[model samples]
Each structure stands twice: as structure tokens, then as C-alpha cells.
Target: MKQKMIDVSIHLFDKKGFTETSIQEIVDELGVTKGTFYYYFTNKQELLTTIHLNFIEFLLKKQEEILQDEAKDSREKLRAMIYMVLQSINERKKSARIFFREMRNLGPKYLEQNVEKRDQFRKNLQQLVEEGIHKGEFQEDLHADMVTRGILGMTNWSYYWYNPEGDVSAEELTDIYVEILLNGINKSD
Candidate 1:
């Protein structure tokens, strides 16, 4: 029942802005009474917070798993992380859209927790970049912080325009991004 409300709310929040979506709409979509929603979530903002947490937590867990793998180099881990996000776009497109687009609607307490998780994701990636540089896998002169942000900007923006069902598979897009990151597009004469 709780999951049903969340799934319905995600669709509603995606189609209608978070501020524009009402509790009644969610319950009506689920064909349940408002009491059922209140039983699981205190209010709409709490539900949104849960949605945000669920998305980021899944990402954090995947990142942690990739980071812990001993066989993969930093470059391989980076590719895995990128592919994980892109694949999520394929599997959870509506959730991704809502996660990115509806963030501003979160209340202060909710926003704080969400921002903390987001920061953790960025910091973890930055650490990966720093590790790559230390191991000579990446350029020594590169700015780890900037590189992390660049990776995130390149991937996260895809929710707005990337077509998971289009000609480019997530694996192919991952390859393209990894190629661009590891080797720039300039032609060498």
C-alpha cells in the first residue's frame, strides 16, 4: 500500500509539478482513502522526501559496491558508476525525472537530508578522481573537485534529454562518455 502511493505519487509528481500535485490526486490514483496515505506518510512532503531518499540511497549503495570491488581499477569503477546512473534512467525514468525536477519542493528538513546525500555522492566521486590521479590513472594536474562536478553534470543532465529507448543504448552512451572523459575529442595530426 505504501509502495503503491509512492509509485502513483511519482507519476503524478512527474506529470504535474510537485507543488501542483495534491494528496487527493495521489489517493484517487491509488483508489485509496487519504487515511491510507496518512498511515504510511505524514504528508505529501514526507512522501516526496521518501522518494528522494529512496533514489539517492539506491545510488549510494551502488556506488559503495563499485568502490569496494578490488578487481576494478578507478577507471573501471568510474565507468560502472556512470553506467549505473544511465541504466537507472532506462529502468526508472520517471523516478529520475521526479528526483531531479521536483527537488525544490522539498521542505527545509527534507532538503537538508537530500542535499547531504547528494553531497556524499559528489564527495565519493571526487575521492575516486583523487584516487585515480594518485595512482597515475588520471592526469596529476587535474582538479578532482572540478572533474567530479563535470562527470555529474554530464550524466545528471541526461534526465532531461536522454532517450533510453533511442538508438543509443546505455552501454553505448557509457562508452561514449568514458571515451570523452579519458580521451578528449581533439584530432591529433
Candidate 2:
């Protein structure tokens, strides 16, 4: 029952902007009464917050696992992280859209919390890039923060057109991204 409510919330929030989506619409999608929603969440905002928190936690856990793996070096960890982003879209495609698209609707405090988590994620990626440069895997001139933001720009944009069921899988796309990311566009002298 709780899962269904969250699912309905995701769909409704994605289709209708968070401001446009009402508690009544979410409950109606679940075919439940208002009381049920109140029982699980105090209001629509709380429900959206809950969903965002869950998604953030999920991403953080994956990131921790990827970073902890010593079998692979920094480059592989970077690939894993990119793969995680694309995989997330495949697994919870609509959730990614809702999580990003509806963020402005979050209360200031809630928005700050989400921003903190997002910052941590970005820092982790930057650290991984730095490690790669130190190891000579990536060019020494590379700026960790710049590379991190570039990767985020590329990966997040995948939501615009990437279909998990379409021609490519997340793993395959990650392989392609890895090549472009670690290698430069310039021709080797």
C-alpha cells in the first residue's frame, strides 16, 4: 500500500508539476481515500520529501559501494559511477525525472538537505577524477571539479532521451562514456 502511494505520487508529480499536483489527485490514482494518505504522509509536500529522501539514499548507497571496491582503479570507479546514473534512470526512470523536476517545490530546509547530499555525490566524483590524474590515468591538466560537472551534464541529460528498453543498455553506454571521459578529444602528437 505504501509502495503504491509512492508510485502514484511519482507518476502524478512527473506528469503534473509538483505545484499542479494535488493530494486528491495522488489518492485518486491509488484509489484510496484522503485518510490513507494522511496516515502515511502528513501532506503532499511530506510525501514528495519522502520520495526524494529515498532516492538520495539509494544513490548514496550505490556510490559507497562503487568507491569501496579496490579491485578496480579510479577510472573503473568513475565508469561505475556513470553507469550507476544511467542504471538509475533505467530502474526508476520516472523517479529521476520527478526527483530533479520537482525539487523547486521542496521547502527551503528540505531543498538544502537535498543539496547537501547532491554536493557530497559531486565531491566524490571529483575526488575520483583527482585520483585518476594522480595515477596518470587521466591527464594531469584535468580539473576535477570541471570534469565532474561535465560528466554530470552528460549523464543527467540522458533522462531526456535514454530508454532502458531502447537500443542501448546502461552498461554499454557507460563503456562509451568512459572512453570519452578518460581520453581527450585532441589528436595524440
Candidate 3:
């Protein structure tokens, strides 16, 4: 039931702008009463908040799984994180779009709360960059926070244009991104 609501929110928000999607529209689509909607969410904003928090929580949990895998070395961990992101985007692709792209209508209060989760994701990436640099796998002077933003900027931007019907599989896409991440644009020996 919770997942159903999340799905409805994603579909409705994607098809229509967040500011334009009303609770009645969602209720009508779900064939549920206003009271039913209220039970799961106080209002549209609350439902949006739930969706945002759930996505961030899901991402953090998966990241924990990859980062805590001691069987892998630092570079492997970094690669795993990148792969995990692609996998997550593939699985939760629609919800991710709603969580990331549609949350501005959530107002500053809710958005501020959600920012903590965003910051945690950044911190996780920053730590990985720092670790990679420590091991001489990445630029030693790599600005961990800056690199974190760069990696996120590159990966998250895919949501705007990534296609399930596209030529590259998600794994292939992850590999492509990783190669560029590790080797960068400069030619090497």
C-alpha cells in the first residue's frame, strides 16, 4: 500500500509538475478517498516528503552495503559505489526522478530536512574520494568535496536523458562512467 502510494506519486508527479499535482488527482487515480490519502499522508506535501525521505534512505542503505564490503579495496569500493548508483537508478528510476527533480515544490521546511540526506550522500562520496587519494589511485591533492560534487553532478545528470531503450546497458554505462572517472580526459602512457 505504501509502495502503491509512492508509485502513484511518481507517476502523477512525472506526468504533471509537482506544483500542479493535487491530492484529489492522486486520490482519483488511486480510486481512494481523501480520508485514505490522509491516512498515509497528511497532504500532498507530506506525501512528497515521504517519497523524498524514502529515496534518500534507500540510497544510503545501498551505499552502506557497498562501502562496508571489506572484500573490496578502495578502488573496488569506488567502482562498486558507481555501479550501485546505476543499479539503483535502473530499479528506482521513476521514483528517483520524482525524488530528485520534483521536490522543489515541497517548500523550504521539508526541503531543508531532505537536504540532510543529500549532504550524507555527498559525505559518503567525499569519503570515497579521500580514501582513493590516500591510496594513490586518484589525484593526491583531489579536493574530496569538490570531486564528490563532480561525480554526483555527472551521474545525476543522467536522469535527464538516460533511456532504458538506449543502446548501452546500465552495467555498460557504469563501466563507461568509471573509465572516464579513473582515467579522465587526458591521454596517458
Cα deviation at 143, candidate 2, in Å, is 1.3
- The 10-residue segment of model 2 with minimum total lDDT is 177-186
Residue-level lDDT tens digits of model 2 in 32-64: 899999999877777888888888789989999
Q: lDDT tens string, model 1, 14-75? A: 89879999899899888888898899988888999999899999999999999999999999
Using TM-score, rank the candidates from best to worst.
1, 3, 2
Name the candidate that leads on TM-score.
Answer: 1
Stretches of candidate 3 exceeding 4 Å from the true structure: none
C-alpha TM-score for every candidate: 0.97, 0.92, 0.92
lDDT of each: 0.90, 0.85, 0.83
Using lDDT as the measure, name the better of candidate 2 and candidate 3: 2
lDDT at position 81, candidate 3 = 85
Better of 1 and 2 by TM-score: 1
Please give the distance, in angstroms, between residue 166's alpha carbon in candidate 1 and its true position after superposition. Answer: 1.2
On lDDT, the stronger of 1 and 3 is 1
Using lDDT as the measure, name the better of candidate 1 and candidate 2. Answer: 1
